[model samples]
Target: MVRAPFLFALLAAAPASFAQQATLSNGTMHVQEGTTLRFTGPLQFTIGPAGALINDGLIDLGTQAVVVEPVGSPISGSGVEMAVTATDGPFNATAPGGLGLSLTTNTATGPITVTRGHLARVFPEGDPSIARWFRLEAPGGGSAPVDVVLSYDATELNGLSGSAIGLYQSTQEDGPWSSLASTNDAAQYTVSATLPAPWDFITAFDQDAPTASASLVARNGVEVWPTLTHGPLFIQVKDGAALEELDLFDGLGRLVTPAMHQRSSTFASMDLSGLANGPYFLRIGQRTTIKLRKE
Candidate 1:
C-alpha cells in the first residue's frame, strides 16, 4: 500500500506489523508516540524523495530492510529503533547490511543511511572473525557524537569467546582500528559503545586478554574474573589479604541480595543465575568496587 502522508497513531497494547512491501512515495509517515510499527516478512520498505519518517514510538525492522532513496526526507525524531541481522556480501541497495546496529541522534540534520559489507578493512591490532563492517552517513556529510547499540550472533563468533569480542572503529576503511570501551553483554551477545566522533567504519573484533598477573589483580587487591559471567562470579584476594564482606549492587546502585554466595578468607563465589543480564557492581568489603556483567 502507498500513503502520501502516512500518519500512524496507535493505542493498542500490541504492535502492528507490515507483512508485505510498503511504499511511502511522498509526504511524511509519522509513527505517533507509544505505538509500535513492526516490519516483518521477506519484503523491503521504500521511502522515496519528499517522503520522510518521523518516529516517536518504535520502528522495529525485524530481519527486514528499508530503502531510503537519496534526497529523500530523512528519518528524524527521538524514539526507539531496532535493526536486522547483518549478512556477508556486497552492498545490496535494497537491503544494505547495518545489521543489529541502531542509532539515536539528538539533533538530526537529514536522513541517515547505514550500509554493511565485507570491505576488507585493516585491523592492525588484530583480525575479527566473521566480521561484517558497517558504514553510516547522512545528507551533507556531518559531525556529532552519537550513542550506538550493536549486536552479534553466537554463531558469528566462530569459536571466539563472546566476552573477548568488542566493537572497533576506524577513521578509514583500510588501516588503524581503535578499540572502544564497550559494555559487553556476554549472555545476550551484544555490545554497546559510544562513538566520540564520526567514524568511517565500525566492526566487532576479539580483544586480547590481559596478562595473567594483571588479570589477577582488579582493585584493592581483589580479583574478579570473567567480568562477563554466565552464572557464578569468582572473586579472590591477593597478597595475603582477606575479604571482609561482599555486597552486590545493580547497575542503578540498588542493593541486590544474592541468593547464593560463599566467601572464605581469600576467595568467594557469587551465584548470578538468579539475576537478570546487565551491568552490576560487586563491592569487596569497604573501599573497593569491581564492575561485573551478567549475561
Candidate 2:
C-alpha cells in the first residue's frame, strides 16, 4: 500500500509574476489536481520534512507575500484556493512603496478562498524587521463576503493618518489582530475592507507604522540571479555598490532593453542566452523591478 508518484505542473495560462524573493528551497511542489498556480509576487514555501505541497488549483496571491515554512509540512489542498485582487482607480497617492495588489483585478468580489491552513510566516520566529503575513479564506460551500479595496502607500503608511490605517483580523497565525471594519480613503490611499460573516485570516496592520520595507532592490542590498534562468543573468551589488541603471522588459510590459544608462561595476552580467523563452522584466538601479524566467 505505497503510492506517492503523481506529480504534474501546468501553470501557464499567462499570469505568473515573481518580482523577486521566492524560495521553495527543496522539492515536491505538486499542484496537479485542478491546475492553477497564478502567482504575481512574493512566495516562500520551504516545506522540509520530506517536502510536500499538494495544492489543487488557484493560488493567486497577487497583493504579494506568501510564506509557508516547516509547519510540519502540511499543505494539502482540497481544491485549494486563495486570491487577492483589489486595486482599482487612482492609487499613486504619491507612491513610495507597497501598493500594487492584484490577481487580475476587476475589483474582486470573490476569490479569497484558502481552505485548510499553511500559509503562515508573518514573522514565525525570524523577524527581518516586521511585515510578512499572508492569508486568504472564503470559499467553502456558502461563500460570500470578500469585499476588499485595500491600497497603501501613503509614503508607506509611516505618516499614518489615513485614520490610522488598520484592518487586521486573524484566527491565529501567531496573531491576535482584530480591527476590521475599515473605510478610509485618506486622499486616495484607499482602504475599504469588509469580510463580515465570520472573517478568516486577513491582514493589513499599521498599529502606528512599521511594515513597509518596500525593497528598492531589497533596500539596496541588491542580488538577482537565476530567477528561473538558463544562461547568464546576475547582478550582485552589495558593498561594492556601483551598478547603476539597467532595464529590460518583455511579457507585454514592453520596454525591451536599452536603458543600461551607463555606470556599472559591482558585478553585473546580463547575457540572457539570447533571450526568447518566456517572462522577463528587470529594471535594477532607479527603482527595482524583477521577474525573469527565460528558461
Candidate 3:
C-alpha cells in the first residue's frame, strides 16, 4: 500500500509532453505565432507537426520565441521562432510589410494576394534604384509545379535591353511573385509551365518593361507583346462573349468566316462533329492562325 502511494506521486510529478497550442479571443487580446508573433487581438496562436494550444483572453505563454518558417526556402523542416517578452505588457504591432506575407488591419483598396513566400526577390512599384519589370510564359497550363517558362523583358527604361526572365506566382498580387524558369529570347522562346492552379486570374509582371500579357482564346494562345504599340497589356478572358460584330476565320489561310459577316459578331459554334479530331486555325481581324483543335 505504501509503494502504491509513492508510485502515484511519481506519476503526478512526471514532466508532461505537450503539443504547444494557444488562442486569443473575445476581450482585450494578446497573441504569438511562429517566433515573431505578438498581437493585441483575441485570436492568435501557433502550430507545428505536433498539435496546437488554446489561450484564454490573457495568459503568459512562457518566454519561448516564435518563428516564421519560410514556406518555400531552404529551411524546410526548420522553424523560425519569434520571441516575445512581456516584462510588463504586450508589444505593439508594427505596420505589416507590403511584400510577401502581410499582416495588418489596413483598409482594403482592392484584391488581396497570398503568395511570395521566398524573400530572395522583391521590388517596389516605382523604385528608381531597382529593376522593376518581368514576364511569364505558361506553355502547357495556367497553374504551377508543372513546367513553365519565364522571360525578363527589360527593367530599366532608357537602356531597355532584354534580361533573364523566370516564372513566378503569388497568392497576393500586391506581394512578391515566385520565380520559375528563365526564357531568354522574347517571341522565339517557348517553355512549359504548370499553371498556378484554379486561380481566378494569373498575372505576368515584368521588372524591365512596362507590361506584357498572354492568354488562351478558343484553345489558341494569344500574347499581347508589351511594346510602344501595345505595351502594358492585360489579357481579357472571353467565354461565349458577344461583341457588336466581329470576324472569324478557320485554321486554313482561306477565310471560313469573313469580316463582312462578323458584323454583330454572332459566332455560333462551328459544327465540328463532322470533322476529324485535329488542329484548326482561327483568324481574328489582323491577327491570324489562332490554333484551335477539336477532339
Better of 1 and 2 by lDDT: 1
lDDT scores for all predictions? 0.57, 0.47, 0.27
**RMSD each, Å:** 17.1, 19.9, 19.1
Consecutive 10-residue window with the lowest summed lDDT within model 1? 88-97
Q: Give the top-scoring candidate (lDDT).
A: 1
Give TM-scores for every candidate, taking all chains together and pairing residue i with residue i.
0.41, 0.21, 0.21
Model 2, range 140-162, lDDT digits (tens) per residue? 52134445555534434432466
lDDT of 2 at 116: 29
| Model 1 TM-score (2 dp) | 0.41
Overall local distance difference test of candidate 2: 0.47
Candidate 3 per-residue lDDT over residues 1-295, each given as its tens digit: 0111111111223223323323211222112233232333222232322222222222222333222212221111112212223222111221111111212222221222222121122322221211222122122222323223322212212233333232334444333333323343545432223433433212232333321223333322232111112112122224434432223222222234321311233332234344433323333333222333344
For model 2, what is the alpha-carbon lDDT of residue 28?
Answer: 66
In candidate 2, which residue pairs clash? 122-132
